[model samples]
Target: MRRLLWLTAAALLAAGCSAAPGGEAAADKQPAPRPLGGVLHHTAAEAAALHRAEEREVRECMASRGFEYSAVPVGDGVRRRAAGNPYGLLTRAVAAQDGYGLTVERLQRHPADPNAQRVSALAEGDRRGWEAALKGTRDGPREEIELPDGPTVSVPTDACATVARRALYGASWDRDRYTVHSLADTIVRETLGHTLVRAAEREWAACMRDEGYRYEHRKDPLEELEKRLDTAGSDPAALRTNGREELRIAVRDAACQVEAGLAEQVSRAQEQVEKALPPARTSRLEEFRAAREGALRRAGARAASTT
Candidate 1:
């Protein structure tokens, strides 16, 4: 789900970079700003200290990259997350803080280590190396805009700001629409299963008729019972079991329909989000979606056919 959300976010950000209504006016009067760099520091600190450090790093990294940068919280949830799991969560939070995507690895030739401390160091070094490599590569264009400090490195057009916005503003809408669709699909599948049960009962009646049980039009219970007994044992459990089986069959069929409907909705939602991403990032996300769809389809089909 997180991956799907991220894919959608990338698409939203990458949508045709129409000039922000006020951005053009600012752009015409200013020089194109330099690109910015960012770093995530996850050391223990007081709230005041942490805030200062974050702001400082944003400033320093931007300066190093020849652009002026300012720190902006991507969402209000960040502080809450930080408050909840200060130590344990920082690792992942810092890892994706830059937010273009996972840092790609260019494996280095490092000596193998058997010592635990040495192995830990090696792992840390690898993680840092990958982050540096990602920061060095071209994630997208350097978008410029007005800032308090003259022409600063405006947040990239394809930034987490829009990604977070899309999830917040549009996710509920998407879910609501998908829910309506799922309910409608579930009902249709359930109705079809009921039809199957009715058909099976009709077939059973025809079979009984073939066995020469007369009194098909008999209104008397005694007459109907006499004819039924002449054909076969009148076990009430048989009909009850048949009804239970019918219900189970209905549930199975309904579940399959629901699964397929969900997968299709997710796929379309993912595509819509992808349209917002930068072309290169968009292409990468598309490849991921295709692979995901293939896996989901196989799983859904297998589950539907089983039992």
Candidate 2:
């Protein structure tokens, strides 16, 4: 969803130069502002809780229709690790430790969700029916549901997925709240593309070049590392070798970001956008936050009752 209003603690620390050793504060560094906290957005934990609630509803809905279903628990470790680096900030300390997180090896070992595997193991005819029931009609004319706002959203009304969402988010959930959240996030990203931020990115790229790495943007180093990881796949020796290389590159990348002041520049740009946002946009953000909180509360209560 759109996530413009908050910066993770890691992002905040990195941007403020508080997380890195020997990092100098830029002369024009704006005052680092704290994020709006729980009021402005849902935490990763809250999102995962809501997802689990939805899965539970889907499983129950399928069971009531005489099909077996399972609610696969979400991986807390993955969520925690991802939230820690939401903006892909690769500090020297983090690089020395994780090195792109063994994502490729983990995925190779567990290619499909356990719940999905259970569904797939059913007889072909039964599987077809279960899939159709869960996902709605496969070959029907598409339909659109309009939200209270002036926007139309599409969903498969005939699918069990729709039922799951309705159960968790109420019958009137048209995803308008999420749409607004997405818009706010887009504003931050677009602001980062402004001239001043782009100049900082160029300087960061040059710094990386001097360190013997060819990268154009702050995200490029991680992206390239991921590609290498994917190529290494499940081979233990290859993974270890590639992972070490990734750590070295990531450490250099983080150093360059600090040296070129990219984090500070991006943070300032984001702050400017947040301050200059129009009243209408701000109103939508509040609405989104309220809706998210209500959904999470309901989901948590439902989960508690079921247990």
**Best-performing candidate as measured by lDDT:** 2
lDDT of each: 0.31, 0.61
The weakest ten consecutive residues by lDDT in model 2 span 1-10
Tens-digit lDDT track of model 1 for 11-78: 44333223223432332233211101001112233333333333444445545544334444233233
For candidate 2, lDDT tens digit of each residue in 1-307? Answer: 0011112222433433343455532321323222332243445677678878888888888888887777766663444353343334455555444445544334333324656777778889989888888887747433575433346766776676778887777655545444564554555566567676788779879998999988887777667767876787777566655655665676666677677776577667766766776675565555555666677998889878978
Best by TM-score: 2
lDDT of model number 1: 0.31
Candidate 1's error at 8, in angstroms? Answer: 32
Q: Pull out the clashing pairs in model 2.
A: 2-181, 2-182, 136-159
Per-candidate TM-scores read 0.15, 0.71
Residue 93 error, candidate 1, Å? 25
Q: Could you report the Cα RMSD, in angstroms, for every candidate shown?
A: 28.0, 7.7
Q: RMSD to the native, candidate 2?
A: 7.7
